[model samples]
Target: MTGPTYRIEVALTAARQLRKLDHPARRRIQAAVELLASDPRPPGAKKLVGGEGEWRVRTGDYRIVYEIHDHVLRVLVLAVGHRRNVYRRSSGVARKART
Candidate 1:
């Protein structure tokens, strides 16, 4: 069973941004959030800070970024993005943005 999933305050903010979009885009965002909640694991180049770890999900032009730490969770909605840029060196911007 996929116990209760927690959308941390930060992740909630990111998800909120998606909620403001049109139906199709909003559904896309919802899908990505669900994907993250189900298995929020960072991929190959997922950025790493002192925090636990970070990962990215894409929905059209937006980037869904998040970090999973020891006892904390954070997420951000990044503009001017794509999956490629999501996993690039630019992840530092995302790390700082979360803080």
Candidate 2:
């Protein structure tokens, strides 16, 4: 018995970052993103501190930063990149989304 799924919206920045990834990494990350539609907080996902409702999931060395809007039932992907820089970049991306 699956529940209603959330709509996934990839921000332009995140989309661009995803496009720059290598083939296998891209595929794996895409799969993980899609899964959020059904389970936005899947196993291993973590709610980021000071992220203003943001959550993150990992796929290998890469990380996908996103936010779940329950009222709208949407999953907004804010950024995607290597673990080292994704967090730093996502905060800026998320700020842009607000304005």
Candidate 3:
């Protein structure tokens, strides 16, 4: 409630990735996603390295990769996966970044 609510949009790649997770993990991720709508940079969220406006939220072993578009007041989720390999692969959101 600190700022304007951000519209959360999950990319197809991210949605697909989310669908692959187990039930409990999916629930946690869903809760995290809801939080992002209210606070794009919620507590415990981290800015991902090598990208402007890119951030990550952790839920157990899973990671939610997202980008904040300030002007548009939107949050686009780029990827969703486990900690071990989430950063290793290029997500749709990551690919869209200039740097």
Candidate 4:
């Protein structure tokens, strides 16, 4: 346990709907999520301008969304749809920039 157990919320309503995916896809999503939750702000979890200072990363077909402060992590998953359309939306385009 670290940082008092970070909070994770799917930013888009559609993202919340991912709870029903089959095992394989579900595992990938889970992996990205756990990384954000447990590690030091992952390699791609960069900061976007708005959307509540949220961050994002990619894992194959899915995007890992998150927010990081001094000591806490908040993951706001925007989409689990598809590769192309995932980033087509503004929120997707606004993900934390990569260095």
Tell me the whole-model lDDT of each prediction, alpha carbons only.
Answer: 0.51, 0.86, 0.81, 0.59
RMSD of every candidate to native, in Å, equals 6.3, 4.6, 3.8, 3.8
lDDT of 3 at 24: 92
User: Lowest lDDT 10-mer window, candidate 3?
Assistant: 90-99
**How close to the true structure is residue 56 of candidate 1, measured as C-alpha lDDT?**
54
* lDDT digits (tens) for residues 21-98 of candidate 1: 678776776676666554565342245443345555556676666654435443333322344554353435454223
Candidate 3 global TM-score: 0.85
In model 2, state the lDDT of residue 50: 57
TM-score per candidate, in order?
Answer: 0.48, 0.90, 0.85, 0.59
> Would you list the clashing residue pairs of candidate 3?
none
Worst 10 residues of 2 by lDDT: 90-99
Question: Which stretches of model 3 miss by more than 4 angstroms?
Answer: 91-99
Ranking of models by TM-score: 2, 3, 4, 1
